[model samples]
Every structure is written in C-alpha cells, then in structure tokens.
Target: MPILIVEDDNFYAQRLKEVLMDFGLEATLVNSTQEALSSNIPLYAAAIIDIMLPNDPDITGISLRESRAGYLSGVALARRFRQKVPNFPIILFSGYFGSFEGESWARDNGILFFSKEDGPGALKYCLQKIGIIREVKPRVFIVHGHDEHALIELKDYIQNTLNWQKPIVLRDEPSSGRTIVEKFEDFASSVDYVFVLMTPDDIVRNVKEDDKRRSRQNVIFELGFFYGQFGRKSGRVIVLHKGPIELPSDIQGIIWIDISKGIKESSGDIRRELKI
Candidate 1:
C-alpha cells in the first residue's frame, strides 16, 4: 500500500518520499488540503500531514477563513479524513517549534505528532508504530572482511539454525550501475539489523617492525555507518570478532561478541538476543 504525504514544500516532500522508497515502500504526495481531502483515504496505509499549507482558495466545503489560516489546514484535513476512516493512522508533522498546542490536540485525537527537526528517524518510528512497516522476519545485513568461508558459515547458521530470514551478504565489489557507497546504503536501509564480522584480514607493521592483524578498512567503515544510522543504544547492531583485533577506541561502550570460543557456541547468545 502507498503512504499519503501532504506537504506544500516540494523539496521536503521529495525527501520524505525517498526515505519511504529506501524502506521498500511507496508514497503519494499532495500539495494542498483540498487534494488530500479529495483523495481515496482507504487506499493509503498511512498519512503524513504537514502543519503549514497554503490556502486552498477553491475548496468548496471548507470555509475560506479556515483554509486561509494555513496553520490549521493539516489538522482540518486530518479531522475530515477521520470522519471517513476513524481509526486510520495519521501523523502530523511540522518543522516549527511552537506546535505544542497542535501536538496536544493530535494526541487527544489519536493521531501522532512529529517534528521534522527530529529528522527522518521520527518518520521511521511512526511508520513502524502504525504497522506500515512490519517486522515480519527480521533481515540482518552481515558485513564481513576477507573471511569468505566464515561469513558463509555465519549466514548459514543464521538462516538454517537460528531460523531467521536470509541475511544480506553483499559482493566485495559494486555492480556496474551504482557506486559501492550507493549500493551499501540501499541494502543497509532495507534491513532491520546489522551483524559486523571483524576478522584478522589486514596486517599492519608497527614502528618496531611488529606486525598486528586487523579487520579490513571497509568492515570498519560499515560498522561506523550502521552505528551512526541506528544509534548505539538501538541494540539492532552486533559486532562479532574471531581473534584479538584492534577496535576503535570510540566504540568501547558498544556490545561485542567474542567468537574465539567458536561461531556455533556463540550463535545461541545472538539468537536469544535477536529473539529468533
């Protein structure tokens, strides 16, 4: 089902649309309250309405004074929509800070209120809450470095033993159409969880000529990207390492599973944590 987005700003509406697409969802954009009110409300999975909108001068049923106010146009449209679909999920969003009154009213009316300043994270949270985004079989994106055999084993255990869906295992090189970063972002955004395997792939020599084993640079980059995208406290991220690998000092507080005991032995802990 497509999501309905009502926003007068073309750029912001397009940005929200991109975010929805990233989640493998579709969206329909409307610029005015009149357009939203006339749409087929039952067709949308959910509605995202912007607080400020231009006056719909030609709207017949709504009063001109009310339409011209702009600030309450979204609220008015939402109320009208509720008349048709009383229990539909509606999210009211505004970048403006002085929206506590509207937010309170929305809460009283069983609608969600989000601030654009909170970024696309707020939109994602609302979508999940309204059942637009389903956590059916949680997909995990596995990022590994130079440990092809170990990576395949982990993927098999996650899918067959743990009974989780097939984990996303990307090729080392990007395909023809897109850059590596673009492909990574597209794949990462679609998954609900991340598993990073830090193996002793790269060897670096110190000033004293002592060599130390570490994970590949790409693996470390992916770990940081996922951490930043889903906050450290999200618990959606897990780092699994084989040996004594050098980790970034900044990620000291994050959880890391030591696989030195064996991947099979450590699999139970991961399965339990993921509720699989």
Candidate 2:
C-alpha cells in the first residue's frame, strides 16, 4: 500500500515523497485536509500529515483560523482515520516549532510528531521503527590501495553483477581534522560487509634483505579492522587479490579470491557468498 502524505507545500511534499521512494516506498500526496479526509485511508499503509495545511471550504464545522493556528486539522484527520482504521500508523510534522500542545495531542493519540528542522532522516528513522518502511540497503566498503583500475573494476562488478549499490571507496587524501584510520573506521561502521582489494602496491625489505611485494599498509590495517568488527568466521569480510601477495599469519585460514582467475568468476563467488 502507498503511504499518504498530507502537506500544503508542494516542494516539501515532493521532497518527502522522494525520501520515501529512496526507502522503496510508494507515496500519495494531497495538499488539503479535505482531500486527505476524503482519500481512501484503507489504501494507505501509513499517513504522514503536516500540521499546517491550507484551509478548505469542503471541511465544514471546523474554525479554520483556530484549527490552522493550533494545527488541529491534522489531529482531527488522525482521529477520523482512527475511527475508520484504528491503530493505523500516523506521523504528524510541522515546520512551525513551539507546538507543545499539538505534540501532546499527537502523543496521546499514538501519532508521531517531528519538526521540519529535524529533517527527513529523523522521520525516516521513525518510519523504520514503526515498520512502515524497510531499512536502508546494505553497503559494502571497498578497501583498496594505489590500484585505481582494479578498484573501479571490482566496484563495477559489485554494482552490476552482485546488484549491490555503489560500494564505499575512501579518498586517496584524508580530510582535514580526521586521520586516515579514523575515516576508515567511520566508514566501516556504516557498512554490513567489507571488500578488500589486495593489489601489489608496495614493496618491503624482508629480514633476509630480499624484496617482498605486498598490499599497502593502509589496506592491511583496514582489512584487519573490519575482521575485528565482523569476525573472520562471520563471512562479512572478503579479500580479492590481483596477484601473489604476502598475508599475515593470523589470517592464514581466511579465504581470498584470486581476481586473476577472471572478474566474472570471482564476482560470482563473492555474490553467492553475499547471498545477493
């Protein structure tokens, strides 16, 4: 069922609709309380009512000046909706702050109240809590070093082959006031899975003075960090190597996909493991 959005402001209403669409929800927009009251409430999964709405002549027996000032029109609509479909999810929002009375009424009537200044993310969270919309899509963090070509290919595979949205790719240069490690940790926390591209980017001197090729220290650090967050056995972390590279002894048993085999085959394996 589509969500019903009652707002007088066309721009704000369209913005709210777009936000809901981002969460994979369908929404119906109406500008007036009269239209909202006349709408088929049962067809809507939920209602997002703006506190202030344009006065409509069809809405009789209500003082528009007092009702609009107090934002009682939305409350009356909610009550009417309850009479029709009890326990229906209703969210009341307003751009005008300082509506303690309106908020109290909404709380008493089991409706959520949010200020426009709180932004759509706050409203989205409330909708998620009430089970009106699904949670945001799972994200995969792509950890790479100097191999931009391989990183791009792997990102494309995740988006095209695995049907996942854009993977997280950190900037080459760190932003001001935040260390590289801090940025990686912040990004990792938001993602459900991490994909490490262990391309041969750095060479190090071994104990015997022989040159050893390896992925960048940053890549290794991020891989270990995600492993610590998700655990090795959880299968939420994946490593793909372009060529032979040295790995720590602690990660000996962890599986690593060889992209040298072919991007198609390697992406397929990763996709299956991700269940996408």
Candidate 3:
C-alpha cells in the first residue's frame, strides 16, 4: 500500500524493508518480476525495482533454472510497467548499477536509478525527489555492561541532543518470548551503527598479573560480535572507553573515544565519527 519493492534476494529485500522502515515508510515486498506484475500497482505510490532478477516463469513462460539471461528480467519488467502506466514513478535499485546494461535506457526513460552501495540515505533522497515524504533516522545499537548511568547518558545524548531515534539497549528491550541471543540479534542486525561502552565493571586477574579492571564478559562478547559483523575499518562500530579498562589486545586499532572523563568530553568526536 506504500512503495512496491521488487527484489530477488531475500536478504537484501529484508534489509531494504528495514531501511525503508527507518525512513518512516512502509513497503510491500515482492521477490520477482511475476510477483510485481501480479500486484495492484495502481494502489502503490512508487516502485523500487532491482535491476538483476531471476526469470519469473509465470510471466516469461521460460524456466530460468540454469540460465543467465534471466539476470536482466527486471529491465523487461520495467518496460512492461512503463507501457501500462506512462507516468508511474519507478526507481531502478541495483547493486551492479555501474555494470548494468540498461543504465542509459533507464535514464532516457526518466526512471530513477540508485545503487545499493550508495546506502539508505541516497535511496530515501531518490524517493523524496519522486514526491514521497521521508523522515530518516539513524538506527543505533548500544552495547554496554553494568554501567547503568553511562547507558542513560548515552541514550539521552543520542535521543535528546543528536535528535535521532532512541538508541537500542538490549536489556531494556522487551524479550518477546525470544532467547537473549535472539533478542540481541533482532536489534543488532537492523542497527546502522554500534556504540560499545567499555566501562570498568568487572575486576579480573590472570596468572601473569594483578587484578585489573575490565568490562563485563557479556559486554566484551557483544563488542566482538559487532566488530565481526561490521569490521573495524567500516566506522560503524564506535568504542567509548571509560577509565583504564583492560581491553582485548586483538582489537587494538579500533576507533575509540576516551569517555573516561565523561560522554560530553567526547561529544565532538562522537558526532564526527557518526558523521552527524
């Protein structure tokens, strides 16, 4: 009933839906050209169509079980849709936009072309150009330990100061009958960035040294999870180290702000890293 999306990859399609939701828009998702053609196109405002798609046997009458020609079926689908409605809004969203053969055709026919690499902000901008109102917010996941005060301050900064959506704190979220890991993942996978709080919440001593202050084990694990998911160089993971906490040696070069004094002290660096 909002935007009709035609994407073949399930993972990418779900991610696109999440991004649209973050933009305060709802989307009806269809997996193939056949599905899109069958939908009530007139009821939707616009369509975000993936350029590379598998052949829909229902429409093409040819099986693409072992064929590569179906890769461009989205182009043919767009052509058919254009014929049906000349002025209908359409966006050709693709991961391979640079190498797509129909780039010129899409431009010539007045279709909006967007690359997956350009990210959700650009996609929202494209929809806006087509007269769709979008309210965008950064989805942030905060990974903290027993530092309740620190967590509250961080959330306040993100919500009240930065004016973004409420930052996700796993423990404070409703479980919804899911295991802790499942609940954590449900929030983690959708967030655009992760803020790890390295607070001195635990004291541990190894055989080689005296007891040292460290973050809770759970915090350490969650930090590793985010690092593994987004990688250290992506700038998606921000570490706020508080005090002289014992950090894992393997993650030495990760970008971190010394929040040992306070979150306000590192507010400038936080904004700069988040690119707000």
Candidate 4:
C-alpha cells in the first residue's frame, strides 16, 4: 500500500518520496492539510505529516491556531485521522520542530515523531519500528588516505560485486560553498556503514624513535567519527588497511581486514561482516 505524505515543501516531500522508494515503498504526496483530509486515507498503509504548513483554501480566512493551518497543522491532521480510524498509523516528520515540539502529545496520542535533522536513516528506522519497511540496503561511506588505487578497488568491489549504490568518497564531491565539517556531516549522517582505509600515507616520528609509516591524521579522525557514530559492536564500521602501516591502538574489538593482497582477497571477509 502507498504511504501518505503531507508536506508543503516540495523539495522535502520529493526527498521523502525518494527515501521511501529506496526501500521499495510507494508514497502519495499532498501539499496541504485540505488535500490530505480529502485523500483516500484507507488507501494508504501509513501517513507522514509535516508539523508546519501554509494555510490552504479550506482554512484561508480562519486564524492559524483555530483552523489548524500553520505550525501544528500536522497535529490537527493526526487528530482527524484518529477520529476517522481509531488506530491508524501516523508519523509526524519535521525539520523545524525539535524533540520538545509536541513530542509528548504525539507519544500520548500514539503518533511517531522524527526530526529531519536526524536524516533519512532515522526515518527509515522509524518505519522499521512500525513494520512498514523491512529491508535495508546499507548506505556505504568510504574514508581513505592517499591510496587512490586502494580506494578505487574497494569502491569497485562495493558497487560491482555487492551491487550497492556507489560508495561515497568525500574528496570527489563538490564543496558547494559549505564548510568542510558541514559537507562531511551532510553525507556522513546518511550512511549506515563506513570503510576506513588505513594506508601508509604519512610518516610520523616519536620523541626518540625513527619515523614510522601511518595513516593520515584526517583518516584517523574520520575513523573515530564513524566509530563514535555506530559503535564498535554495531559492525557498521569496516577498516581496510594496506602495507605495514601503524594501526591505532585506541580502536579495539572491530574487524580489521588487510587488503595488502588486494581487495579481491578480502571480499569474503567483507561479505561476511556485512551479511550479504
């Protein structure tokens, strides 16, 4: 069954539709509360309503609060849906509204709330909670040192072999006037899996010891970032190292695949860890 999406922002609504499509789900988008009320509610498996919406013809002259046209329009819509179907599934998805915004009311009324800032993964996770979406194609992010060859091989294995979407490489993406951290988070927040390549890209010297080959500082930073995001036991972060590079002792209890013999040799390990 199709899912109902009530959102005024066309861009955001299209994005939500795409996210649903990725999981082989269909969506019916309605821009206003009026249209949503008129939609065939029984045709949809569930409904995702935006918290803020503009006033429509049905409530044009009425006050925003009284007519339920603005900020809490989704709340009003959810009430109406519940009135029609006592146990209809409804989710309130919003970018402007935080956890404190009508969250308590939603919980008390049997409605799920998700913040867009948490990214599409969180929305899908919510869907999984409600038993709407069951399958998940792991979104892959690649963090690598200066080893372009290793990056290409691993990307090829992920795309061609695993048949997953092209793994995201930060360096290849456009900056688009955003800060490095902003750009990183824009991509990183969407991915569930990470592949950090610890290549011998840098040489570091200790207080009284000779210089030893190690992964770049940026690579290590990204590794830690993803590790913190997914945790060690989540099995979402994969570390691929080449050569006799000095590995970080701080990271423990995670699978480390050696690609010294090329990415092909470690395909079995990768597949086993990813369970595909």
Candidate 5:
C-alpha cells in the first residue's frame, strides 16, 4: 500500500516515511502544501495530511463534505478521484485539533476531519483505514446488520453465481472494530465505489435505534472529515436503501440514495446509482 505523507516538517515527515517503509508499505513525503497538490497523485491507499498547512486554505480542508467552488483545494480535488476510483484512504493530520463548524453548513461542504498530534495517530489511523487483509481478494464490506442473509446471498450471487470478482465480505471481524470514519478514509483512498449494501433489516435497525439521527450525524461529522481532507461528494456515494428514507437533518438532505425492495432487484439499482 502507498501512503502520502503531507507535512511541511522534514524531521516529522521523514520519520513517518521511514515508519511506513519499515512496515512494508511505500511512502511519498512532501514538505509543502503547494508541492502536495502539484504531485496530482493518481491514487493513494492513505494520506497523512497536516491540518494546518501554512497556506493550504482558509476553508476547512480537514472537514469538507460538499463544495460550492466545485474545485477548491488539493484535498478537495481528491473527491473527484474517489468517486471514480474508490479505495483511496486519506488522513488529515495536524499538531492540533480544531472545533467543528455549523452542522448543515459542514455537511454540504465537509466530509472527514482529523487532528495530527495523536502521536503517530495519523499513521495508525491510515493503516486501519486500509484493512490489511492477508489475501488479494477484492475487499467489500457488506454494510448490513445481523441476519442479513439476503445481503450474504446477494454477495454469493455476485461472486459465485455471477462469476464477478470475489470480494472479501466485511463482517464483525476484529479489523472491522476500527472506527467507520477511519474505514471510510481507507475506502475513499483505495476503493472506487462503496456498495452501501442496505436492506429492510438495515433500515429497520437504523430506524429503530434512530439510525437516521446517527447517519445524519455521521454525514455531518464523519463526512466532513472526508470532505475537508479528501473532498468527497454525495455523487461518489452509491446508496442502496432497504426502504425509502428521508434526508436526515443537515447536509444529509443533499445526497439521495435510491431505494429497492429485494436482493435481485437491488443489484440493477446499484448499477444505475453508480451509473455503471
């Protein structure tokens, strides 16, 4: 896996680079915000960024979820790549942590957020984001709850039945214990499209537990991290709702996922959602 370390400090940046190399990964170190952007790196499994780069931008690159400028910062630019090319992970690091901005405003404009001073915290977060599986199977997390057999069956259909690339199904494995926000960074960094594997059970579980509140919160807070750090959008998000849903409060209202009734019917829906 390749990790892009974005920091202006040679000592710290080099230190991080060496760590990644020692751990069987490639590291590309850059010392300035300008240089980081100019690289136009095609894709990266993870990125370690300095949240407070001297002249990076006034707007929160570490918390952008949506964009009005369409194209703003290098981090913001990464979103375009993420939609077309998923699996690229991004880490927004800073020696300091900052407070969040407006909720609705942050959602429409922010995605992911992080602080750099966690003591290799950024690096650790990056590694976890790109789950280090032993094999080379295409990693795909079936985002459903317990007893999501339909999802499992759908997965089998896609792989064993349809002869599609077999994806490493995401279950309650120890690795999945990592925070979803961190995982999204990895997915955004590396995967092309996140199959939102939703089902009636998922909707039921989320709705019963006020998942709408949580999902909305996730969109604003977590999504802001990606928006600010990697610049992702709702367009890049391919949603598969088990049932109809309301745009939760805040920016969740901006992105819409089409709903489907069953497994077989859902497959084509996702294809259409991604416009594949």
Candidate 6:
C-alpha cells in the first residue's frame, strides 16, 4: 500500500515526509483529523496518523509527551480505527508520552503503534516488517583534500540537518576500509551519484610526479577508477569542479549540483530543495 500521513502540526508532518522518501515511499499529508477521516487512504501501502488532533475532544486522556495528548488519546484513536478497518495496517504515533499504551491497544485491534521517541528507527522497523527495502538516497562519496572541513560541514548538513542517510565510507565504517584501488574498483558502476571538488587546493596538492604523485594522484586514481568501474553506467555520476579541472568525457555527461562555492543557506536551502 502507499503511505498516508495524517499530522496535525505542519512541521511534524513535513519531517515525516522526508523519512518516508528515504524508504522510496512518499507520504500524503492531511492537516486535520477531519481531513484524514474524510479522505480515502486506501491508495497507500501504510499510514502514519498523529493521534492527538486539534479539534478532537477526547480530553479525558492524558497528554502526549510531544503534543498535548498523551497515551490515552492514542489508544482511543487506535481502537477506533481497528473497529472500522480491521484488515488495514494502521500506524499510531504520539510525541507526548514515552510509555505508549498504543502497542497493547494495537495488538488488540491488529494495528501498529510507533512512539515518536524511536524516531526514524521506529519507521525503519515498520518498513522492514512490510518488506520495503532499498537505498533511495544518492550514495555520495566525497574525496577530500586539504579543504576537508567544507566537505565535512556539507556531510553533516546532509546527515544531521537534512536527515539524509549518507553512507560515509571513512566515518561510517572504517574497519572494513579497503585500499583506494579496492574502494573505487566497483564504485563507479554501482554509484548513482559522485561529486568531485576540483578546487585549487585539491588539484594542486594531488599533482603527479614521476615517482611520487601525492594528493593529485589520489584524486586522479579515484576519478579514473569511477570512469572505468561505472563503464556503461557512467551517465549517473555527477562531477563537481571546484576551480577548473575538466571532467573526463565519461563523467562529464552526468548532471551535477555544485556546492563548491558553498550553500547560500544550509537548513532552509536543503529543506526547500527537498521540500522537507
């Protein structure tokens, strides 16, 4: 099923949308409980419903930790949906309380309740159970030179601020770190995206010598490795030049988003670009 997302608050709903994209499923945003109840959600594979609605009057229940309603509101919602749609898989979410009575309620009603505290992990768990698996984010590899700081900042933005899943080769898993030759061997063909920061520092430092080509050699090797590895799949690579080094013909074909000059506004820019 597709994923229908019902969130009362605008910001929370938007955040859930980004998480869904990573799973290759886009969420349908319904603002109010009325909108959610009125609309047809069957087109979706699953749904994310915020239990505590603004106009909903189950005030007797405790408040949710993140929002105003607590465990009780979620339980009521879960119970209500289960009675109406017995077969449909429904996800109940609450930001209010850590102890979600929703799970017990869901078990009774044959629905699933996820705590907001678990964050994406909860969503990931839910997706896994439903058998949706694959990498939706562009696997980006940044070959750093002296200006590694800029790359790191951008990486952080992508991971932390942007909430994008970046499998950083060095940072994420260093133990399995293979030689540069091994890393780029199969990379180009499999990689959907690549960014080459052809800055003066990167190029000048990586310059080749007869016996010892330093930083320049490293950059060249990685680029060449991708060129060859990608082989027929070379069109997916993105080559970003920092100063002026021309991309080889193979990689030159791919489209690129240049962050060499730097992003004008990080948080807002990314959110706007991705429509978070």
State each model's CA lDDT, in order.
0.80, 0.76, 0.78, 0.81, 0.48, 0.54
lDDT of model 2 at position 249: 73
RMSD of 2: 13.0
Judged by whole-model lDDT over C-alpha atoms, candidate 3 comes out at 0.78
**Candidate 5 ranges with C-alpha deviation above 4 Å:** 1-6, 10-12, 15-30, 33-138, 146-149, 157-193, 201-237, 244-269, 272-276
Cα error of candidate 2 at position 202, Å: 1.4
lDDT of 2 by residue, 1-276 (tens): 999999988999999999899888899999887888889898989999887776554464446665765366777677778888999989988776556567778877667777675556457656965688675655778988998778878878878876776888888435567887677656666665688888888888878877877999888888877765554654678888887677767778767788876567676777766665
TM-score of 6: 0.41
Q: Give lDDT tens digits, candidate 4, residues 1-276.
A: 999999999998999999999999999998988888888788899999987766564553335765444777777778888888888888886676343455566777767777766578768756875789874656689999899999999999888888878899998889899999999988998886899999999988898988899999999999888765554545678888899888887765557898999999989988888766
lDDT of 1 at 128: 76
| lDDT of candidate 6 over 199-251, digit per residue (tens) | 44532232454332123546656656554433223242334444444444545
Worst 10-residue stretch by lDDT in candidate 5? Answer: 97-106
Candidate 2 deviant stretches above 4 angstroms: 1-136, 172-177, 207-209
Give the residue spans of candidate 4 off by over 4 A: 1-118, 123-131, 134-137
Query: Clash pairs of candidate 2?
Result: none
Q: Show model 6 residue runs off by greater than 4 Å.
A: 57-71, 132-276
TM-score (all chains, Cα) for each model: 0.57, 0.49, 0.57, 0.57, 0.41, 0.41
Task: State residue 42's C-alpha deviation in candidate 5, in Å.
Answer: 15
Cand. 6 Cα-lDDT: 0.54
lDDT of 4: 0.81
Q: Whole-model lDDT for model 2 versus the true structure?
A: 0.76
Q: What is every candidate's alpha-carbon RMSD to the true fold?
A: 7.9, 13.0, 8.6, 8.7, 10.6, 18.0
Model 5 TM-score is 0.41
